[model samples]
Target: MRIYVLSRQKLLLGLLFLFTVGGILAITQFTLTTPSLVRTPGTYYMANTPEKVVALTFDDGPDPIDTPDILDILKEKEVRATFFVLGKAAQSNPDLLKRLVKEGHEIGNHGFNHDYQQRHLVKEMNQTDQAVYAATGYHTYFYRPPGGFVSKTQLETTNRNGHVVALWSVDSKDWRNPGVKQIVDNVVKNVFPGSIILMHDGGYQRSQTVKSLGPIIDALRARGYRLATLSELKTLDSETK
Candidate 1:
């Protein structure tokens, strides 16, 4: 019957639309932020080097309370890290930002604002890089998109600006305030050679992050991994090569 034929066509169209959306999500889930250009021109972090080196990168912070505590731990540990600080936070907490630089930690840009959803709208990649450099007086060559969200344009533009698009292999999810023990457990369990671990020092109550850092560092070192800032890790890798 004509009615039956129309029903079948409608069902087929609905199925096709669902399939198209699912397919796009599947591809974007992993490859969404990846640049189309296969080659990474200037080296940022070594992808898979065999040294007992790991990079600890903190995003979204420089919070007055948490940032100082995080810095204290890092100072005690005598280890360096990479702080992907937001520009707005940097402007507000100039001393904390300066202290991060003074203490030998490598600083990277995490944009002017911490809006996890705003990728390329407020500030283009060029503007982002300039603002960070102008505020911090350090040329930021590494970028972590806010909230781990990035579009094709953001990734391509960041790469074009000579900044590597940073993604984390280990996420503490400490923002969730998972008990400090759980956060340490998660990080220790997931870390591997060449792993870039993500944590935050700048926003909200990050007491857990500060608490977890010492144990995490001790555990990772006990497991034969040495923590390095991004630049130091890159340098160690380059020296060997």
Candidate 2:
């Protein structure tokens, strides 16, 4: 009887040890995959506001072909948006960047080449900032990492550059060119007050994005939601709060 009791206690202790180690390993894996959640400060997924307003932000943009179509649609609708542009793209199409500022839109840094490794983030950010400023004379205050991948060093570097890291609450997935209707549905269905909607005008085939833009704007406006740039949305966020 004594031997059986000792063996049962040993089994319970071993199981407890395994459970603890497994829990720790699981947490470490989670943090590694979702570093933005653990490392960044003021990383806005969505603004906490009750007002019927949303920020429309585009990434990997200033494309000569698709960007003009997007700007035309926004102009017709009188809706302004923020464009997170790559430095290399901006240098190639300085006029489009200037036109974005002239049309009352905002420009955010998307790094020099949208580097996936997230190396030299600060240098990339500065290069993008200088490019936009040279083209449009507008200084950017927002930086969105490519693919929304954030690291501890990237976060620190971005903050040190005096830029807020912008993330999306509603992703249109338009980059996939997943049918015009699907893209419109993604934004309209997911958008809420103070929500940031992500779309693309540059990387990949964006004809679907351009086609869906007009409808998305109309849908959001029909729902009594005002489309604003990131800077405008930030003001609304503060006011509503």
Highest TM-score scorer: 2
User: TM-scores of all models?
Assistant: 0.77, 0.83
TM-score between model 1 and native: 0.77
Runs in model 1 deviating more than 4 A are 1-46, 119-136, 236-241
- Displacement of residue 206 (Cα, Å) in model 1 is 0.6
- Tens digits of per-residue lDDT for model 2 on 1-241? 3554458889999999999999999999887665334434558667778899999899998899999999999999998999999999999999999899989999999999989786888889999999999998888898899888886677777888899898888889887788999999999998899998889999877999999999999999999999999888888676445
State the displacement of the C-alpha of residue 47, model 1, in Å, after optimal TM-score superposition. 2.9
Q: In model 2, what are the clashing residue pairs, if there are any?
A: none
lDDT of 1 by residue, 1-241 (tens): 3554458889999999999999999887656443322223343434467788999999887789988888999999898999988877776777786788889998888877766666453364455556556655777778877766666776677677677777677777787899999999988998888877889997788888999999999999999998998877766654446
lDDT of each: 0.77, 0.88
lDDT of 1 at 146: 73
Q: Which prediction has the highest lDDT against the true structure?
A: 2
